[model samples]
Target: MRSVAAVLVVLGAAGATGALAQTPAPASPVPALDERVVVTGTAAPVSAGAVGRTLAIVTADDLQRLPVASVTDALRLLPGVWVRQRGPFGSQTDISIRGASFGQTLVLIDGVRVNDPQTGHHNGDLPVALEDIARIELLAGAGSSLHGADAVGGVINIITRREASAPTARLAAGQYDLVQGAVAWRPATMGVFQGASASVDRSSGFAPARDFVHQQVRADFRFGRTTLAVSHLDKDFGAAGYYGPAPSQEWTTQTLVAARHQRPLTGAWSVTGDAWYRTHGDEFLYDPRVLGARANEHRTHVVGGGLRVGGRLSSSLRLTTGVEATGDWLRSWSLGDREEARVSGFGELEARVGRLLLYPSARVDAYTTFGSAFSPSLAVALPVRPRVKWRASVGKAFRVPTFTERFYTDPNHRANEALRPEQGWTADTGLDTYLGGTWVATVTGFVRRERDVIDWVRPDATVRWRTENIRDVRSHGFEAFARGQAGPLALGAQYTFTRVETDRLAGLSKYVDDYAPHGVGGDVSLALPWRLSTAARLEHRRPYGREAWTTVDLRVSRPIRRVTAFVEMANVGDAQYQEIRGVAMPGRWARAGITVK
Candidate 1:
């Protein structure tokens, strides 16, 4: 295994040079970003034009032009984000943000929490089809402040396509006989509007058990002051022997419905009410006898409302304040009759003076299944010079036990309802700088200390694993990012270093022995003068208990009239590696296709 890994690393490096030579010239410069929203961190709204984080804006043009088979492919351009694909098609994706555990990250779809209430580990199995996405916002940091709850590491908000003024249809065909199609339309009157979209995708086997089928639909309508949306996603995936057993097939289904109403109050105040319902299903197996048949199903019902009122305190100062209320109920079939619910209320305040902004927020979580607690956070951003800025934040966050951790039961795992909630405090300081007109750099360092950390514990080989809380674990990390445009070509790269440790471990002296470390990656894209574009990417990561590996990928495309043709190479050198342990991923593969925009 070590020899195979080494050979792939060398091959990946050599292929980078060859891929660059075959790429196109370069495209025009990325526009000076404006209209970028900063809803992920500070309590108040911050635009990309005002704040300095390693923010990368990918426009609709960028999304449409890429030769992407899935949404994860489009996210590769952002710094501090890495993806591991198990096969040629989008069977499984392991995305890590800022070297944080996958379960620590939170994913939101149009303000609705997509993270499974049973286990955070299943959040990445987003059912929404990639073709339905309008835009994606990636906030790479501990976003416990603005988002509340599960956003300990980062937040990924996916915005779905809304009602457009025109109708559109897209059809695509690719390698391995892959086929996909999408159609959408919108029609509206003075007080009534309706929009809908449907899409389907399928592919032949690239490796054993690598075939997949996906279908999705979204429908929305607006009448008067009320709006409603309903969406569905279904996928059947053959994971092959990647997860230790051949014919390891998994199927997933998701359904969502949301409704909202908005009304203007006195002066600048606006009151809004929102509610949503979600259902998810998952089925997977290793072998019929050893692993047995496992199926998990969950449903969530959420309702909430909030009021926001803002006005000018003075010419230079702006004051914005709001209060919100939310209630959520979760039910799981795998939990053996267990149920959970939470009701929360929050308040926030923001103030700005000169080139500085400060925000403070507080929340009170009242749970029906567990006890309640109060959480608070504070943040500040200041521009020291025209080209430099400094920002810092301090906050407190907590994580409640999931249903799978407290009530689920299996032959290999047992539930522990006595588990205590995990609590933590985190702080970070960062600086952003722009040099000349060709380079931008950002550096950030953060430290987090958590108590009552939860982990699955095993007493002996004969006993089933159970959830337990361990005391005193600390983690710290730093990230450096830079992007530059030399002439017509755009280049960018980022590096991350992290250390995590627990004091309760017996043999290991430090927690760093178990955490991810030394993550470095870079991505570059160029657009030629002849309407042809090309992009290349490289990722090198070495985590604890694993061998280091580097991956190279490329994409090339040309447009003729309204049709665009392109080819994508993933793991161009066919690196054999694992993002998740015990999973043996496939080697080099390519997909070629064309799309009508």
Candidate 2:
């Protein structure tokens, strides 16, 4: 309690100083929205103001200003999104959107799908370092029509840095015996742009068997209209009590090699293509200290590619078409060996008429194992006024059962091969309003109706849990957000409410029912004198079936010539809370670091 009060006092003082030192900019007579380009919400790049769906854009500047330890931490600034981490510094993380399960979200890097084919548990294992990112885009709600499977809830795209820049290095150390170092360089020569980065982070255990080591390497080259990137990530962490209540330890390594090409043809016409390969290896020990104890080893490989073309049909009409193919194979001692392949094609049209915009898209996917499925979506946007817009969308999405949910067998769990794909429909409507040139506010309401929702269930406590498909389930939610900037200060706030409806069946066990019913989050950033800056964040959550909790984080930094020093404090209240059940989070930990250019 005292710690929380102290943090509040410090923030209050900083706010006062900021207000006195800087004044707000004069408001424009007729404010106009910035013409920001976004590619994630549609088949072709479009202005953010024209997109009919809810989207959040996090820029490189935002990443540098936030005191986040990992890419997932920075995502919390957006509403209707939840990021759960078991350890610090990208050790282990899970992301969910709008009350959906973790597996329903899709992750992409440089426009290539990175979601693991075996399971969504490893989707957050991004291979690129923070310094290598150019920007991140989050599109909420079903995106299956634009991106193939695993996009039931939303999509997150992490774009890599490509601009020419000087080389920079960073080093940091802090509590829990943490040590980290990174270097990034981007240079253009002979009509070619080249970028490369490497980083490593390690920390001693805060508790027994809670240590971790993370390493990454990335390289990208661009010549003319073609670009190629390759990245590798290695992560080894003590996963004690991470899965269920067992004292488990695990190690994992991932490799990604991808290439992309784009060429502009005639007026308003372009072609793009991408190919990538990924491999992941996992080893788990039920008890590290007990020799010959139960253990599992698995290795999975995924290869995929896609080609797309877009052109204008008329002055206000555009069309895009694409084809994609993906293959997944797994070799494991416990789950045996298996393979599956899929082919998909999609098309979309964007038409504008006066003050109204319309987008319609459809996709057909043929899977070797599960036959075929078709998904479609329609979205519309209407301008209520010059500064106000209303948007609505409806879409269908699906998810195939993962290998771990089908064939794995253990003492405490069993898999079912008869499980079918989960299918659902999502609908949403929202309004976006711009107040002057510095303030923006949005409100959105959404509902999801699903059939054959997958879940693990057991008849009794003494029996092992088995995978099954539920008959029907429904979820609805709403989110509100506001953000503004004034001189050297920036402020943002978000709130969300969700409700789930399902039939109560006897002897049915449930997981992922731990989503928060209500959540409120806010952030503040101020630039003080002498190249000094400060940021603070607060998050409050009220779960459906668990205790509610609030957390606060603060950071301060100063830049001096070629060197910058910064310090961050997390869980300033020293609150004891568990994001994942039975996994205790750290409290009141402090870290400081320096960067040189």
Candidate 3:
């Protein structure tokens, strides 16, 4: 499972040598930024330019042009986001934003929650295939005012395509005997459209217990105002240093089915409703050869639904209200069988006066076992100039401990049933402006004050780690990004700095303190003559109180008739680094592929 990253550094540089000198092509159309209406930040359909919060949108074109293999790969390029990966290609990953814990970030598909109830470690286990995705919208702040629990840091929403385009088939092979094949098909674009995608990927182990095999299947149906989708993900990967001391093996499967529809009434009134059901199963073997090494097995099922009504009452006022309910059931070997149910109600009002926009929203949630809480937020956006906009938001967010954090017991860790729900207040203000007619630059400062922060702590090396509400913690950060597209060159860059302060404690904390204190990244794509082009991504991450490391990935591709051929190098610098402590990651990987459309 080894990759040849360092050996191919010259290959990437050679592709871009004379590519940008020959000709200067025309850039894209008028909208330097996207005009698509986003739904993650608000109940109303708000355009990217009008959003009052820090939001980043990765469109379909960006997905195809980037040096990435999966949706997670594309997400790593944005600002205020951090991805801690245990496996190289396909495996468990934890996503955090603006210094929040993994469990604090919310993951959703078409506005339906998909966060695992057992643990946040599995939150990255998305069921939908990459080919089925249309775009990914990320909101990098508290979103509990409209969405329910587990939205402390921000929200990630995956939007699927509604209409059909061209069918695609792709095949690729790389080092470590890695093999991949994917196919996407969508029939008709007008009435009653349907789409489906399937993909299979496998690789030999980079090290002991490091091999992985992943598969995904998804189908979607759209007719009139109704949309339906079903997806499943299966994964078998080496847990290795992911959990305890021993090299572990784990297998997981996730399936989700959802349905949504909307009805438009007279005089700017509408109603929308959605329902979803998901099931996940996981089995782990700490070590099959060792006697009493301890193994864990778990299964979880989630059922959720929501109804929303209201719309534009006039040109100046828009109102939306909704009710949501969800149930979670878990069965585990060491965590014991547990279940919980929650119901929530929310309302939002968007008022517009002249060039100013105001948004106010509130939600109340009641849980059978976790009691009730109210979350309220307000956001404002003002156009200081024709090309400049000022935006700011303030809100309260909370997260109830996952079942694993409260009751799961393992050889290396213990749970605490006395843990309390974590809560925090979030606020941010930023300015978005058009620079030099081609660049869209944004700079923002944000902070969060959290109470009863949760973590697994052990006083020393002898005792097992246990869950505890480690008093108070304050996290603050600054984020900035500049993106521009002119002629044949498309450029993007982002910088982030975060500092986490915690009350003095006896033991070391597992995740609350283990964070990337600083990050800098950028993406560059250049179109060359004769359909030959190259793209590269650079990432520099500095772990808290540790040496920093940098990595880059490059891809070069060209088209021939209906097919496109490409080659890629991951971790181009061959930097040896670990996203998590005690875990070792491979250096320098190369792959090649062709796509037929």
**Alpha-carbon local distance difference test for all models:** 0.64, 0.81, 0.83
Give the best candidate by lDDT.
Answer: 3
TM-scores, each model vs. reference: 0.83, 0.93, 0.92
Task: Give the CA lDDT, 0 to 100, for residue 127 in model 2.
Answer: 91
Q: After superposition, which runs of candidate 3 have C-alpha atoms over 4 Å from their true positions?
A: 1-34, 189-193, 291-294, 435-439
lDDT of 3 by residue, 62-113 (tens): 6687788866786786688888889976488888998889999999888888
How many residue pairs of model 1 clash at the backbone? Answer: 4
Backbone collisions counted per model: 4, 0, 1
lDDT of 3 at 144: 93
Per residue, candidate 2 scores C-alpha lDDT tens digits across 73-98 of 77787778888778767677778888
Compose the digit string of candidate 1's lDDT tens values, residues 456-488. 766466667777776576777888887666765
Residue 292, model 2, lDDT: 71
